[model samples]
Structures are given as structure tokens and as C-alpha cells.
Target: MLITSGNSMIQSLADTAFAYGRREGDHDTSIPDLTLHIRNTPTEPLHCIYTLSLSLILQGSKQVAIDDRLRICSAGQSMLTTFDLPVISHVTEATRYHPFIGLVLKLDYGLIAQTCTELNLERPSKDLRYQAISTQDIDTGLCDAMSRLLGLHLTPEYIESLAQLYKKEIVIRLLHGSHGMHLRHLASVGSPSRQIVQIVAWMKQNFAQAIGINELADKAHMSASAFRQHFKALTGSSPLQYLKHLRLQEARDQMLLNGLDASQASGVVGYESPSQFSREYSRLFGLPPQKDIQRLRQA
Candidate 1:
């Protein structure tokens, strides 16, 4: 029962990513939280920061670089990112007819916490943060819950009344899954993830300028060394490594949206050394910035 639904959800999401390829000029695909769409295409390598969102691939495959770690997710697999970290991701293969596809459920932790309290579910102390969620199979409890909630997506009249119920069910399903274990980590009162959340907020608000670790640490209300250790424990990267990813990802925006050259894009993203920027950019994205941008434009 639950196993079957997991299979169905994966197949559905994968089919969606594949549909995106037929649109032409489709970059790496994405399906919003309420809806799922996927398509595949043979595309030049591309990269984007997987903002702390829940992503599940239904078909084809993708490779993701998370700081020092590398992860590959294919059909029937999913990942949840708790912190807003930098990531380099690319679809390995796809085609116009049967593109890669996926489903996304963006978890709102605040909503989950509130629901937990309302439902009389006790949260753990806020001093713990889990690193990763790797689940091999989706259980029956999770599958049925998702199906009912998705059906609700079609009912606007009952949406407001049912939102909290659906959202809470979604969290409960995730909590029961391997990836769902992070609810414990996230609830810890002063946990590294708590600080990481603060840092994530600050970074989003202040990504345009160079930032100091001391400043970030202060935002987390910790000493510099302690902040470094905890940040690495949760995000698997040094402060600078994380910052570099942010800058490079920002440059990707310029290339894809405004059509900027690499040099100009580098300047916009705060790169003083053009050659060094190019190397790191290529290292993360699998191509020189100009070529990738040009390819993106041509496609």
C-alpha cells in the first residue's frame, strides 16, 4: 500500500521533469510544491544552489555537489535540505521526448512546529541538528497522506480549511520517513541548525556584499571558532566555501536571466580575481562561465 504509492509518486514526478524538455530552451527543470512536472533533454552541464527545499526525482538522474560531498539522486529517491547551503547540480542525461522529472514539497518548519504544538506533539530540545536524510523506500503511511493532500490541491474552496491539516500530515509523513528525522534536529532549542537558520536568513538578506565570519558568528550568537565548528557540522563546508557557492550561484542568475558575460558577472558577484573566479566557477559548474552562458542562450 504505502510502498505502492511511493512508487507511483516517484513515477509521476519523473514523468513531469521529462515533460519540461519539450518546451525547448528549458534549463534544469523544476516542479513547484503544489504541482509536479518533469522533462529530460541532453543539456550542457548546469549548476544552481538547491535552496533549502525538499526535492524528489521521479525519473532520470541528477548529480549534486554539496560542499565537499557529492550526491546522486535518481528515480524513486528524494532529499531534504534543512539549511540554505550552496549546491552544484546537473542532470546527467535527458531527451525531448522523455525528460527527467520530479516532485517538490517545500517544508515550512515554522508551520510544522506550530502544528506539533497544537497537536500536542512534543518537540525535542533545540540543540540538535541532523546532517542528512536518506530513505530507500516511502512507507504506506506517507503515501496515503500525500495522495489525499494532493487531491486537495484541486479543491480551492476547502484549501484554507484543509491547509494546516495537509501541511501537518505532510510533516508527519516526513517525520516517519528516514529524511523526516530532521524534525527532531530542527526542534532542538539552541542547536547548530537553529543558528544555521539565523545565518541563512542573514545571507539571503545580505548576499550582495562580502561578509565576515565574525559577523555571521555574531548573528548566530557564538564565538568565531565555535561558530565555525558547528556550521561545518551542519553544512559540511567552511564559511568561505559556503560563501563562494553563494557568489557563483548569483553569477548563474546573471548569466541565465540578464545575459551577462563572465567578467561582468564576476564583478557583480564580487570577484576581484577574474582568473581565480573562472577556475572556481568552472570547477563548480563543469564549464567556463562564458561557454555555459552561451550554450544556455543558444538552447
Candidate 2:
């Protein structure tokens, strides 16, 4: 999405979500996509999910950390995560007074790919070095379309045919814009972005095993440094950082989805020192892993 469309979509969504509680520190509202509410706090250290359709920030500010790399996005800004990634997310500042709100748009690779072809966009190269970009760079045209879609969501009496057209139009702009390359990366396989995607596939398929950077690099047919550079460029994170995201999110999955305990789940996900894991978990997610799980359970 261009800067304009991106900003407008965020505003429109914020208006919709804001209509609900008036003030909510931490909340979730599921539309056709996901709306996340984050309150004023020190920030969170929870492991992140890389893939899934994501657009971030309706209000306030937060930072996303994967490995040692971090990116900050705030109100009027947005992020699109094309691949499934693991990282730590935090809401450094917000309040029921002004919460950190984010959106998650569901992804459909086939939809994006088919749209790209119709638009005459070029295919992305194998091995994407740079892909993820801030939505603040979006233009007004895209924003206007997205605002219309958001408006559609607000209008219950309307038919939904126009929403699909708006969606396709947004993808076309993304295709032609600087970040169009990122979407193309997903559609055309064997590109650098796609190569990292292949590695991501392996990690997901085998999250329990020890990872070798060289092997992952070889999977993409790039050397270690080259792979690291390109990987960071595309996803804004290093290989180890990417791996950790897989591990931590999986641990959360085991706890929330599979109903596992903290220590056991940590070990299962490849953490050797449980204490270290706890510390890192606390830092990344704010609360200790166990406490967070408990809170979720209580809720």
C-alpha cells in the first residue's frame, strides 16, 4: 500500500475499533482481519508470528525485535509481513487513553500473485535482500481505496463486491511501488525473498532440530554472509533471529494451543538453559512466560 492509502486505512480502522471500548489497554477485535490493542507499558517481549496478513499501528508506538534488529512503527504508519516471521513485539507507550492499535490482514498468496500478472508487474529475483517496508511511505491513491474498504466494513447494509476490487487495486499499487518487489517475491518462486521463504519453510517443518546457518544458506544457494544480508534485507532480521522467532512462537503455541508447561515447552522448542530462556522470554514478552500463559488462561 502507498503512504496515503496506508495511513487512511489505519485511521478508518482505528475509528472502527475505537468505537468499541472507548479505552482498552490490551484487546483483540477480529474483523475480516485482526485488530490488536496494546496499552501504555514498558513494552512486550513476546515472540512474533512472521507470516499472516499484518498491518500495524492505529495509535501510539511500538518496536518489533528479531535477533538484534528492531523496527519501530507508530500511529499513521503500517507494516506488511509477507512471510511468517518470529520476533518480539512491544508497545513502549500507549494507554486506554491512547492505545497502540494494529491490524492483521489475512494473506492470500494466490490472490496477490494473480493480481500481479494482470498488472504486468515484473517477477522478483530469487533471494530477496530487502522486502518489508514501512506503510508510511505509501501514497494517497492506495490510501483512498483502503479507506473505501474500511468504510464498506462500517456500512452493514452494503453489498461486498466493491471490497474485492479495492483489495486488488491496492495490490496493484504495491506491485508498481518500491515494495511491489516484495509481493512479487512471494508470487515468483526462487527469488531471494522466496529463497529465504524456503529456509523459513524448512525451519517450520523442523523447528525442533538444531539449525546450521550454512545449510540454510545453501538451501537458498547463497553463502552464509550473503544469505544473512539478504535475509535481513527481506525480513529485517538475521538468520538466528529468524530461528529464535520460530522457536519462541512455537513455545507459545505449545502453551496456548497445545497446553504445555513453561519449562517443558521451552526444552521442547530447543532452549538449553531454562533460566536463560525465562530471562529472554521475560525481556521479549514483558512477563515471564508462565505468568503470561496464566493470564491468558484466566482471561
Candidate 3:
């Protein structure tokens, strides 16, 4: 039956992924765009930004919350994010015997655009908007392509020659899959969604600096009101709210990874008031900066 074969394919993919992501952390493969994640235990909600990428869950499960929408992706499924959006995610199922294994492939917007033109796909109306994230069952074709993509690591010499081909195949599969319309909408030149994506990329780089919504709207060539509406529709957050999430997440990273204390991290991330930073940090992360960093370290 179709379901039986699908499960088998997923298991094979899991095996391939585990071979590379054997250690309990994120592994960057020789392929520049491909990364693998391995986790042996459930985790606290970790906040971060997801760029244009496809994350395939080969084993176990994860819960990803974007704004108010929460999606659960288990084995045999994948999550596609069309733009840069701040998200909170955590492993929901994993164990020493059955660790969670996942593969993340950074998608190329240029390639998506090229594929759309080659296929003559109709662009969605500029007035319409789509959510930045979606989850769907991975079809057999996509699974096979991904498995081969991972297998390319074994023959590194072939990777340089064939990786782009496989990556293009994966993009084509996505274009025909559930996320096709959304991807098309975002990749279309001069679309509002595409403009918002560019703005989000800018936000990521300049998050540590003070930003104004009107300034960003001008950069996107939209009136303040129109920009705000499109931005919210696509990312599920207002411009200021999204910036807050970015700053908080960056501050947490500084404290956890760089040994910055709460005040120092807050200042580094552009929070003028340490008290205000602690308040917002606790609101978003469920603990003060010091406590949250300590918990993450213990985990």
C-alpha cells in the first residue's frame, strides 16, 4: 500500500540522516545549504528566526509556534518556511534509543523564481497574502530526492557537480507540492510578499539597532498602512512585534553562547533599559535572563 511504502522511505531517510547527524547537535554537511539536527531529548521552547528553508523531519517530532499558529511535524512530514520569521520551536518526542533526526535545506529564492518562469506558473495576485510557514506530508518523490541529496556526502567529489541539480529537483518538487502557491507568490518579482521578504532580511542584520516602521515601509516602497497590513498578513506579526522577538532571541543567544550577562546582553541587543529587557525577556522565555540561560545550559 502507499502508506507502507511511504513509511519505509521515511525510515530509510532517517537512517541516512542519523549516519551524518550522529552527534547530539546541529551538523553542517559539506553541501553548503544542507544541515542536519540530532536531539536525544525533548527541549524547552527555543526562539529563533527561520529563513527561506525546508525542514524535513525524518524521525521523532517537533512543535513549531509562529505567532499564534502552532504546527506539529513528525516523521514523514516536513515544514516549509517561505520568509524570515521569528519562531519558537522545541522537540516534542525523542529519546536515547530513538533520537530525533531532521534535515534542513536552505532554499534559494532565485532558483524558485527561475523554476516558476520555466514552468510558466501564474503568479498569485499581488493583493493576496500567504502565511510564511506550512507543514505537509513529504511525498515519495521528495523523500527519494532528499535521501539521495544526503547520500551525496559519501562521494564528496560528486557533490560539487551534482548538488545543484538535486537542489533544483527538490525546489521543483516543492513547487508542485502543497507549498507551491505560497512559494510562487513570494518569488514573483515586484510582489508585496517579495518586498516584505527583503525587509525581513534587512531586519535580521540590523535588529541590534533602533528601527522605525515608517522607515522600513519606505524601504519596501509601500505606504505605512499598506506595509503594515501586508507584513502582518505574511508574518503573523506587526513590524514592531517582529522586531521585539528578534531582539529578545538575539539577546538570549548572546547570554547562552557568549557568556554575556543580562545587562550586557540587553545593551548589545539594543534594549535601552535593563529592567524593561528583563521584563520582556521573562515574558517571552518564561524566565529571567540568568535563570533562562542556566536552564538552557543544564539541558
Candidate 4:
């Protein structure tokens, strides 16, 4: 049974999100770092990158997967992604009459660190083994704060001054919630998780460049084997596997958004052999580059 506050918060968020996200795509808001998503029908599994953010399901449900791990988030639940991760996700439940509505807020690591300091949050002695993605019931306080943030769309005048405070409240509530430990580790200095996050950020900026596990491990200041263990534990994939997923996702974006052809997209994302790129792309996305792009366009 949902608490009364939780139920009210869901209704509030759903109503506000529908007002802004009436169309069937992501809607960027005037509020900094916030986006709303609406879907009228169940969608095919989509391969994309989820940055450090919190996604709250206001209505319906969805399934998200990273490597072999899968999580299902229903209404009143929220998913926290502590790192920028390449994930496969699809709407699991939705209909035209009752569309899936969701709110996504980008998380700022700097703000998180500052909030931790202000709150005097202590670092955990050992970095707990946690995946980059986690799902939990939305805290009532956090849900209410999100509702207010979305409601700001109706009153744009105060957005410039008030949005940051609301965003900070959301982060503060997040730090006090179930996913707090994972987040705390991300903010803690010299933690393996934090180091891995740094490495992931570097990989994202230089994904098209040739990358080696040893080089990445060195950057993380860990031996290759330890780095591999921590990386897999946190991201659900090894360093090389994560890089491959990043490259493939980027190539897909290039083809879909920039009108790049399959071979061109392949080479642009650092694939030396178009055939090899096509093989891996097909394996990951279930279609060759051209067909995938065609399908996406037709959608």
C-alpha cells in the first residue's frame, strides 16, 4: 500500500509531467537539468546511455538492463544511475489512455559533494559493491520535491532563482534515501568507486580513441586485475566491454542524428573494419546499422 503522501506526490508529478510531456517524446524543461518523458505504448528495447541522473516513474512501468542485470521500476519508484552507463531499456507497461510518465533530473557530482560536506555525511569504510543503476521506492520527501520542481513549468518567472534550490533539495533527499551509500561512495575522495567514475568520464570523452585496459587501470590508480574487478562490480561490465558499448551507442547516434552511413559511422567511432563494427552493432542492437537507423527513423 502506498503512503498517502507518496500517492499524492505521484498524482502531482503525473499531472505536471503530462502537461509538459503531452507529446510522445522527451520534453526539456525550463528548469535546469530536468526532462520529462511520455510514452503511449510499450516500446522496443532501446540502446542508449544514461548519465548520472535520477528517473522517477510517475505512472506505468519500465525495464532497464545493464549487461545481464535487469531492474523493473513501477509507478512511485525511482531509478538512480550513479555513473554514465550504456543501458538497454523499454517501456514495460503503458497505453494510449494511460501513458507512461517519468521525470529525469541530471545529478551534479559537485553539488553532491558539497551537500555531503554540508550534511556531514561520513564516507563508508569500505566501498560497497553496488551497480551503477539501482531502483528504490521514491522517498516521500523526494517525490514531493520533484513535484514542485515540475510544477515550476506553470510559473516560469521564478525558475531562475528557485530551480537550483529545488534541485538541491532533490539531491539532499536522495542522499538521505536508500541509494545514499552508493552516492556517498561516488562523492568520497579516493574511493575505488569514485576513481572508477573518473575513469568512466575519461572513457566517454575519448571513446573513439584506441583504449587499453592497462592504461585505464593506471588512470584509476589500481592494478589491472583489481581495476577489472571493481569496474565489473560497479558497471556490470569490464573496461573494454563498457568502451565497446559506448562506441556502438555513439555510432548509432551519429547514424540516426547526423545521417552518417554505416561505414562512415563505423570509422568515425574508431572502428577500423566496417564488417567488424556491423557484426558487433548487430549483436548489440539486433540490427545492422542501416536497418537500425531506418527503423528508428520510421518510428
User: Among these predicted structures, which one has the highest lDDT?
Assistant: 3
lDDT of 2 by residue, 171-267 (tens): 7766776566667777775566667777887888887788788988888899999999878876667788667767877787789878888898889
Off by over 4 Å in 2: 1-13, 20-31, 34-42, 52-56, 123-129, 154-163, 185-189, 209-229, 232-241, 256-258, 267-299
lDDT of each: 0.66, 0.67, 0.89, 0.88
Model 1 is weakest, by summed lDDT over 10 consecutive residues, at 24-33
What does candidate 4's lDDT look like per residue over 83-182, in tens digits?
Answer: 9888889999999999999889999999999999999998865737665788888877887788888888889998988999999998888888888888
Q: After superposition, how far is residue 291 of candidate 1 from its true place, in Å?
A: 1.9
Per-model TM against the reference? 0.78, 0.71, 0.93, 0.96
Highest TM-score: give the candidate number.
4
What tens-digit string does per-residue lDDT give for candidate 3 at 1-299? 12232488889888888887688999999887999999999987888889899999988899999888899998878889998888889999999899989999999988999999999988776555476888888888888898889899899999989999999999998888877888888888898888998999888889888879999999999999999999999888999999999899999998889999999999998999999999999998899999989999997
**Per-residue error at 247 for model 3, in Å?**
1.2
Reference-based TM-score, model 4: 0.96
Worst 10 residues of 2 by lDDT: 26-35
Q: Output the TM-score of candidate 2.
A: 0.71
lDDT per residue as tens, model 1, 1-299: 33532476645533334443435333432222544545546444455555555665655667777666788776566667766766666777556555666556667768756655565554554553466433345555655555555555456567678766876776876665666557656655676777777787677666667889998888889999999988887777887777787888888888789978788888988888889889998987778888877776786
Residue 105 in model 1: lDDT = 67
> Which one wins by TM-score: 3 or 4?
4
Residue 192: error of model 4 in Å?
A: 0.5
Clashing pairs in 4: none
What is the full ranking by lDDT, best candidate first?
Answer: 3, 4, 2, 1
